[model samples]
Target: MDKCFYRRGKVSLSGTIVAVGIFMLIAVRGMGQTGNNSVYRLTIAEAIEFSKSQNKWVQTANMEVNAADEDRKDVIRAKLPIVNVNGSYQRFSGLTLFTDGLSHATTGERKPTPNSAALGIDALFNIYGGGRQHALEEEQHLRVNLARLNAQDQSGNIALQTATQYLNLVKLNDLEKFLADQLNRARFRLNNINALYRNQKVTRSDVLRAEVNLSNVELSLEQNENDIAIANQHLDVLLNVPDSVIIIPADSAGMTKPEVSSLLQLTQSAEVSSYTVQKAATSVDVQTAKLRSIRSANLPNVSFYAAYGLNYPNYLFFPPVNQAYSVGFVGLKAQYGISSLYHNKSKIAAGKIRVKEAAMQREAYADNVRLDVRSHYVKYVEALRRIEVNEHSVEQAEVNYRIINNKYLNQLALLTDLLDADNLYQESRFNLIKAQTDALSIYYHIRYASGNL
Candidate 1:
């Protein structure tokens, strides 16, 4: 009766401890759900979206895209005519109207004309620049495209990173719960071992071993808690949230493998959809446009010139008079750099080589993208297989642990055997958690590689 009463007392104490652990868990979860400053329940989608808006790399890339668009606008303005307005007033001695200062020399007059003022507009529009202007505008357009592609690529990268951290935090949360359960079980086993010790059914070594097992579980819990803290802080940095905010991850979503078309179709899709490939192609276009611009050096340039600007005095007549004059004229101007026809041979050759290099670079990027897609798809398939295997392993380990625990209670199995089974069970569960999270991560990797992330 005494031994039985002692067993009841031990069970009661252990039950209280387990209840307290559970209560703490519930309280923390409740705090997380209440949207308090100290605790927050974060979902995967929310984390990713917030990170994109706040991530430094993503913001910088978008800013670069804006700058490139501004540059494109500046280039477009080149098509507009160069225009200017001028006005001048002069007094005698300073020459109100000076016909190259020849009126004073020829007329023996104090000044060609006393005070005079005039104002007009002058304009020059490029009629032809041997395609240089067209090439320059085209280059700017290509640059804008390049910047946009780069921004897309960077945004996708940041999103992928955010998702990765969110998933990792979810994994750590699962591990924490698992460790808590393990701690409760270890506590129960230790209490039973102590009861057995009271009845002299087990040696002192068994009680010592049970205490060691409980300590190990508690230590494992502590270590897991530390990991969760680190992961939480890292995620906070990613989302740009306040450091004091504690993020509790919500339930991890089941992985839905995206429906992929045939490999042929995916390859074709990547050719147009992949930012890396598109950026490389844009580089090729930029180089080709630059080549065109360089070729223009050897060609003559033509422009339409129209200038209507007045002189201070009426100098066109034989006898100059003080007046505010209005003049209007227009003409065509042509120019050729005779030296460039011979001097640009090396430059033109270099430009052609760069164009070829750009084309080669584009082809290289396309090939890499195809290879990357294939690699990720293979990993995704492997992750699925791992998930199936790990799930079966967990089921087997749980059953084995149950059988071993029963046999030990019946005095048929050794304590070491029970402990080994417990460890196996925990390991299987851990592996299964990682497998599930890894499978989802690999799916996202495939999405990233295909340029759909």
Candidate 2:
């Protein structure tokens, strides 16, 4: 009876182990599938938001702005009182005695301790810098503004890029669906031909032809799937997501067309609102401030300084012995670099030239912005027209395919004709998607050029 009980216990334990193993296997498989099929659904706006928050380029630009702020703070700190402290220690082996000056008699040697130490603190405040300090402060302020404008420009560029990628993904999704339908149709045609062959109503050659067509369609479907993968990977990079994650557009209809003003109005707005133009204008101001700072170099610098320190073995007494005492002094100081009077002319001239160069570059950028706005506007209009034409083409292709399919079924049309009509239908649908996506992309491009994005 004990043996019997042992056998039963063993059996039960084995069964439990097997059950647990099965459960673990099932759990792991479920987890793997979930990981493989992770999907993130995002709209265009959400995608742009994600890019702004997560994109490396945008983050770097923000860091630049922070660095510029710190630099500005440094410049301001330079104008405040500066304080420093220092200490020193020294060791001597012996002391030397010197003769008295009036009597010309040698004095006995007085040797002090071998160790000595001293500590001191000093402070200085700029009383004047010939206006150079103010110019430096202004220049640093402009640098901060320039960094901010640069960040704005980077954000706009990132937004436009994200929008474009999002739209491209939408287009790829539409193409995927279309290709799937085409694949299904091809398979159905092959099955129909096989049935006809079994009934001896169609030749074997016809079956072979249908098989070939199906194979071609299958290849095209596979290629379309690869394209989808590539598009998803690009979106992942933009949104700062893992490459394995698939991004799906929640709204496949694409972005709405923004109401744009006239080209002249857009150009005018761009001149004022464009981050590039603003940065360039600030650059000119910065250069002008720099020139003022350079000119200030020729003037005198005035400052007030004070120092307090303790010294060992004061030298006021002859044959001095070791003693400690505090000494202090305060005074106003003025200094000028005489060479600046003769050498600063060339530097000043160069600074002026740089200011002029900056102004010229700003003007050139404005001209380019106007050209860019007009070009994008024209592309947007053309895309709109294409979308209209393709919409009608899709309708016509659908009608033509239906007629061809019916005739083929009635044994009055060839498979080639039916296939051709189907291909045309798919192409028209693809064209429509492309046109819509292009229109939206071009619209964002226009906004980007105008720095409104």
Candidate 3:
């Protein structure tokens, strides 16, 4: 599935690829190089892939995911103990010890070491944080997931955009080809009219009519050529190609008809797979985790601490010693914030509100996702029906054109009648091509709405 989204838009396994291949085989070929520029050819799948890598929104989303992952790692590290090894050397200007403050003989204790060196190691690990650490880790993990979902959503968006633009370019190219065909027919009609007028079989009015028709087709062809050129430049910008490079799609739209069972099925699928819904759901989890973290402040904080130190002229004794001494101790420490009892109350209440808000927001997004999926599916069905309708119209117009062309050749029909038939035929062809492309567009839009694209 080119749509396996780099990660969820997986399409019909091998069948779709083969179908696309066959369709493109019959679709438009390369438009050749634009004047004096490098010709870059692209297919629809290739265009979508380019959009994922080159589109700024997708790039930004990917960056967010990376940052979120790093954050999650940081949160995990927060649970680990902090260890420090510290050392210092010092020469004292004067040493003073006050033994007479607690006993007699102050002068004897005052004869202390003039220099000292000390080293210490300490480790502190949280024994308890009212479960705040775990909650924080959970929130960070969910945020990382949320970021990933956002990235998937962005990838789907860019892919859909690229596909839509690519299809538009293809539709215009198809029209240009059709119009060129009509232009040829117009010239042939005009030449035949001139021959008939020279033989005095048709009036000059008829010849003038044919010439006017030929000019009209010429003007239309010119307009389409210009549009195609503009489409080329737009595509270059869309693909994020260098200004010096032009991307001409080697495409002939051959989108396989999307197989959908029902709107209910799609809605259900979206609930399970949709990135928008998933992101919203993750948001709820994030908020819930945050609330838990906030509530954790209600419990007393506790930690285990261990420290070992060596120092000259030990100060732990009543009389200061000149020799070095070492001490090590390990114990648990506990603390409770008296202010948090009151301060945390409002914060927890607000946190609870936010959790509810987040849940409601998830529901809202899920609702919109379902609606979007349903609407697109309906449009897809309509587009498919239109393609059917336009196809029959094309058949009828083709027959009508043939009949009128024959009648005009037999001198049994006016030039105006034949020109009308030609116009109808062209219009019908244009409509069919348009319907085909529209159906494909709607199909992808449906996928995008469900976060599958």
Better model by lDDT: candidate 1 vs candidate 3:
3
- C-alpha positional error of residue 353 in candidate 3 after TM-score superposition, expressed in Å: 1.2
Off by over 4 Å in 1: 1-32, 35-38, 89-110, 113-118, 253-268, 317-324
Write the residue-wise lDDT of candidate 1 on 323-432 in tens digits.
54667888999999999988999999999999899899988988888888777767767777877798899999999999999998888899999999999999988888
Clashes of 2: 0
lDDT for each residue of candidate 3 in 1-453, tens digit (9 for 90 to 100):
233223353222263354345434433343233333366577777777666666667767878988999999998998899999999997766534556585643332233677778899999999899999999999999998888888888878878888888888888888988989998998888888888889898999998888888888889889988887777777667656666555566667555565556335655688657888888888889989999999898899999999999988788776777889999999999999988889999999999999899888888888888888878777888888888899899999999999999999889998889999999999999998888888778777777777767
Model 2: residues with Cα > 4 Å off, grouped in runs: 1-37, 89-92, 96-118, 194-206, 260-267, 316-324
How many steric overlaps are in each model, in order? 0, 0, 4
Candidate 1 residue pairs in clash (backbone atoms < 3 Å): none
C-alpha TM-scores of all predictions: 0.83, 0.83, 0.82
Which 10 residues in a row give candidate 2 its minimum summed lDDT?
A: 1-10
Q: Find the 10 residues in a row with the least total lDDT in model 3.
A: 4-13
